[model samples]
Target: MKTIITSALVLGLSLSFSVSAVADDDAMMQAAGKELFNKCSACHSLDSSKNAFGPDLSGVVGRKAASLPRFAYSEALQKSDITWTEANLRKWIAGNDQFVPGTRMRHVEITDKAEQDYLIAYLKTL
Candidate 1:
């Protein structure tokens, strides 16, 4: 009976730890996303229908490239047939020039894959 109790306790503790770890990871990712977004804040706006130097990023996660009706996009981006999927967004952030050459916004790359993921996750919230 004591051995069974001990095993149950161990299992409970392990499950608790697993839950905690997942929560901690989520928190950390959010923090990283916020930090990374600062670099984009100068050009992009999070509010709907509000565009700064760049178009509003309020729903950018699943949005197609250069698809904001109010914002004038570069010819290169307008001509490109890129959709902002998770993989595409990751690639775009990591290397904008490579992703779309002749883009007016010449430099907008987030090289770190983890950081890119976090930023993408945060963008989905907008």
Candidate 2:
């Protein structure tokens, strides 16, 4: 009976550890998204008060697709008629101009879902 109890305890501990490992993986994925954003940094700025070659993206997560003031968006993005939701942002990052057909951003695709989610989640925090 003591042996059986020990085995059950071991199993429970292993399951708990497995769950913790999965949570770690999720956290790592979010970190990967921030890494992905580095590629876009040349043109984009995270700070709302500062403008880059691209528009400032301080509140872009929930902002309209092509509604930044002063900065000129390509005719393509201007007409996308879409909002910047996580799903849509994923699609955009996978291949920006291709997805929107007229966006000025060059075609760079971040195909990993974890990376995409991480980047989108970070954007929401901005």
Candidate 3:
């Protein structure tokens, strides 16, 4: 009985450590994502301080598409009923035209999975 209990405790500690280690990935992803968004800094502002060619994307992680005030969203974008999610952002960034037909964004697809993961992480923080 003592041997079994000790082994169980050890196993539990190992499992807990593994779970905690996995959570570190989320922070890493967020850091990586910020680096990816540097490319977007030219045309978009993630900070609320100002707007650029694109609407400010602050807090855009779960926001509805075209929901920002003052930006003139195209009819195509305004009517799409799209919501930004990690998966949807990936699609939109990869090919905006496919996601919203007739929209005007022209960014080239981000090809690195790590970068995309990081970008989504950064967007969530916005």
Candidate 4:
């Protein structure tokens, strides 16, 4: 009985440590993502619905592309029928023009996958 209890305790502690590590990793990723978002802040606003050179990205994850009524989105984007899934976001962030031809926002490609992941992580928190 004592051995079983010790084993259970060890398992519980291991699981707790794993969960904590994952949380720490997520926090670090989000922090890095926030810093990387500087590249987008000039054109995108995460705090409000106001449109700038780009539409507000306050809730962009899971949102439809070109869905903001107030913003004048490119015809291509408006018709693309895209849901901003993480995979799609990765593609869009890497190259908007390549992802959707004739996109009005001329974003420089973010080629580094890790950086893209970081930015996406930050965007998710918005």
Best by lDDT: 4
Inter-residue clash pairs, candidate 3: 33-118, 33-119, 59-126
lDDT of 4: 0.90
Mark the regions of model 4 whose C-alpha exceeds 4 Å error after superposition. 49-51
Model 4 misses residue 123 by how many Å?
A: 1.0
Q: Per-residue lDDT for 34-62 in model 3, tens only?
A: 87788888888766667678888888888
Clash totals for all candidate models: 0, 1, 3, 0
Error of 3 at 124 (Å): 0.9
Ranking the candidates on lDDT from highest down gives 4, 1, 3, 2
lDDT of 2 by residue, 1-126 (tens): 999999999999999999999889767766776787798888888765676888877678878987977898888888889898878888988888679886777788888887788888667656
Q: What is the lDDT of residue 44 in candidate 2?
A: 87
Indicate the residue-level lDDT of 60 in model 4: 90
Q: TM-scores, in order shown?
A: 0.86, 0.73, 0.84, 0.90
Could you tell me the lDDT of residue 13 within candidate 3?
99
What lDDT score is found at residue 31 in candidate 1? 80
Q: Please identify model 2 stretches exceeding 4 Å from their true place.
A: 1-29
Per-residue lDDT, model 1, residue 125, is 73
Compared with the true structure, model 1 gives a TM-score of 0.86
Stretches off by above 4 angstroms in model 3 are: none
Clashing residue pairs in candidate 2 (N, C-alpha, C atoms within 3 angstroms) = 76-102
Clashes of 2: 1
